[model samples]
Target: HNKRVAIDLTLPEHLPVLYADFKQLRQVLYNCFANSEEVMSDGGKITICAQELAGERLELRLTDTGPGVADDDLKLIFKKFFTTKKKGIGLGLPVCRQIVRAHNGSITLKNNPGGGASIILRLPLRPLITIGHGRRTNRAA
Candidate 1:
């Protein structure tokens, strides 16, 4: 890829650990980064900031230097099969929301004052140890 993009990760020195599937969480991050990169076609800086919320939550913010999405499209961005890109089949943000929810988290998008789009993902500080539905046992002994 010859595209020039800058990514800045602004995270706490000692980040708290969460129990989650490495692959799934990776996909979530990947989608966000890819989305930001796609919007900034001509090379722009993407800032990733993370903070610990007051209510035992983790907030991850991905900000890009591309023109922000229209206000009308903000609400529809996370909707399945919705996209502003020419080749985008849409599913990216929708899947991101779903994945965040699975981790008992949330995702939101808004426009930055200067320009560009800011997407925030808030996740629980204490996540479930396992990622599957608990095993059901027949206790009728």
Candidate 2:
């Protein structure tokens, strides 16, 4: 199953990272990918991309070539414990939202351009600080 789902990852040249829990982030991403795979069932593709935006913000996008979400469900996808799947506990997306918001970031879900679903995560990147002998520099905007 892992071999069938194509995963693509892209990151910025230089990214400023805020105080984020890496373990939680990994869990969120893993859950997203797992959900996508479940929806695909027969097999499909998944792509993850990240880029640095202006004002020290980072944009992370996850797209899946599976059945897309309906318009009505879009607004409620992030609600705590709300899920459309019959077998799901529905905590995945809500947990993801919580983790992102905890870091002063935001997450949104939408239908992909052609077909399938897309999850977009926007995070405020922290600036870098450099210090030297009697000199200090702030890399955050």
Candidate 3:
């Protein structure tokens, strides 16, 4: 859309690395930013904050300044083929959720009390790596 979208990134210098599929994770972030851009056609701000949660997981909050999502649509946002945009096929969020789940993470969306919407993603810092006999182990990468 050629919109001027400003990104506000907040992350600690010593933040731990997450163990995940690089390509899939990048796609998730890209899809989120694309969604924000599509809603803010004129221009807007996207605030992204990343932090460690009790040394167990990483929490990433992506808040957009575009018009917030509707209450009724919130439940259906992650459902396949559910979209509010005229040109959107509604696979973005569903795919994002799927990718996140594949990494043993979770993705959620909620409207900001002030305005716009926020997408919260939580991923384990040490993703479980399965071994023989269904044994699992955590190794941060």
Candidate 4:
């Protein structure tokens, strides 16, 4: 955890609540942040922006000020075991994609026009919630 890696959050005053698996979502975020931190070893900025989309979905975009992914590798960024890091086994982005899909959401990565990379995650605002055996579960609405 580098204290120098600053996170700037630009969010709506009132964001819609999401019915999601907290642990899984947290892990996804951690993976994204870790990747950014690793690439910006000297420290950089991570900007996070969130907004509601047409009352049907929530969009969260995370952008980092590190060198963006190579154009040739963009297609394989979320593939399992495909990594640019010397020590990475390449499961991070794949796992993140799986988690996002399971939540009935979509995740995408793109290089910024000026520099760095941006990851966009879009999820439904209202997920179908069901209770069974004293446990709650969410599904695509």
Q: Which candidate gets the maximum lDDT versus the true structure?
A: 3
User: Whole-model Cα lDDT per candidate?
Assistant: 0.83, 0.80, 0.92, 0.89
Alpha-carbon TM-score of each model against the true structure: 0.86, 0.81, 0.92, 0.89
After superposition on all C-alphas, the RMSD of every candidate to the true structure, in Å, is: 5.4, 6.0, 1.9, 3.7
Which residue ranges in model 2 land beyond 4 Å of their true spot? 12-18, 127-141
Clashing pairs in 3: none
Look at candidate 1 and tell me the lDDT of residue 64.
91
Candidate 4 residue-wise lDDT, 77-108, digit = tens:
99999999999999999999999988879999
lDDT of 2 by residue, 47-104 (tens): 8888878756788899999999989889888888789998988889999989887666
- Report lDDT (Cα) of residue 95, candidate 4: 100
Ranking by lDDT: 3, 4, 1, 2
Which residue runs of candidate 3 sit more than 4 Å off their true CA positions? 1-3, 132-141
Write one digit per residue (lDDT tens) for candidate 1, span 67-137: 88998999799989998989989998899889888887899999999999888988877754443487432
Off by over 4 Å in 1: 1-3, 129-141
Q: What is the lDDT of residue 71 in candidate 3?
A: 91
Task: Tell me the lDDT of candidate 4.
Answer: 0.89
| lDDT winner between candidates 3 and 4 | 3
